[model samples]
Target: MTTTTPPTHLPPPYAPTDSDSDPDSTFRHIITSMLNSHHHKFGFLIYRVNYDNDALWQNYLNIIDQQTREYVVLEKKEHLLPHIAWTPMEDREKFEGATKDEIREFFRDWIHERSEDRDGPGAGVDNTELIRWSPRYKACMYVNGEMMQGAKMQTVDFLPGGPQLHVQGKGVVVDGQYDEHDRDVLRRSAVGAREDFEEVEGRRGWDVGWMYFTLRGVHMVYETLCMSEEEWTSP
Candidate 1:
């Protein structure tokens, strides 16, 4: 049986013109709409790794830690974290015949181990905090564009089937799927966002801006997922 692929394409970086709505305003609208309609509690956290070039992974772990801490404080109420998962390209190729359930389990176990207290001395920093780790897989590119004066949007696409996080001014929107082609499109899309934004900035003579507001999409997904999972699995 043929499988359907998920839609994954990074939207080109856009700068508002006289005729365009303020990017920031539009971003806020999107976020507010998402939060008001979606039945999930989402939040974001940022972190830097002490060493290594894997900033994404480090950031992911940092966010996870933050979420965990929040979960503890809230007594696992309101905020729930998502199940962490990853699918390395090498591993996927090595086990081409692996079933979806098997792959999910593999990632689930990997995430659980990484989250365990034994991963390292600092693994469990605080029972009240959660750490953010990088996404399980790598994307071709992660494009972050300035949506407004202090706000930016990040769109990422990874290889194989995965999820896309849209970071807007008010909140985040996450959509997940399991399709290789969609993954490819998302990877390329992220690259496109980066290129498009860079080109606009160069042409307009604007300095590179700090990403804010919209960069929390991933964190939102993680928190919502975590909360939902906890509720579902709770006795």
Candidate 2:
């Protein structure tokens, strides 16, 4: 996918001045820009494990597979279908039955091997990391701050000059800075809305500004609200 260079002189991060103004517009702008600019074949796979309940896990997998099937057709993209990859925890063990710890170890090692293959010497310049984990599961592919543990979660390897967002379950959360290399790439496109808003509202009283406007903090709040609305109405 293509990326626009962030503006050279981006102001400090945005902060909200009032309750009514939404800050998530910034995130939407960034996400939309990334999607439009980058034309790569991007997709995601989610694997779910229930510590003790095999039936629940299987039900969840079937539900997700069915949903994915619908989404593939709707997107008119075949690649999006088999985009989901699932393996049950129970099946990971043989008849001798490896312990959960052993299975986890195997899973990690398997993932690392795949990552190495995608990024190794003969693998060209391409780099990739698989398996991002979060404490909670939310809707598929609509990740945001409210559904995650924020700072405590493991970070994913962000692609340079590509779409970068946190993935947990089926959702994508947009928070944190992209990797430093990608940050540099995005630096040129960075718009300084925070400073601009502060300048415009500098003359107003603190209470008035605070009551009437919101800074960058509003971005998460707005995103949460929007996602909530979408989930509530979605079939």
TM-score of each: 0.22, 0.27
Could you give me the TM-score of model 2 versus the true structure?
A: 0.27
lDDT, residue 68, model 2: 38
lDDT for each residue of candidate 2 in 139-231, tens digit (9 for 90 to 100) = 112212222222121224575744322322322221211132443333335642222323322331111111211211222332342333111
Give the per-residue lDDT digits (tens) of candidate 1, residues 71-140: 3333322222232221112222322344333334433443344322333222233422222222211011
Q: Which ten residues in a row have the lowest lDDT in candidate 1?
A: 137-146
Q: Best candidate, lDDT-wise?
A: 1
Off by over 4 Å in 1: 1-90, 93-99, 111-118, 121-216, 232-235
Q: What does candidate 1 score on TM?
A: 0.22
**Candidate 1 lDDT for residue 182:** 50
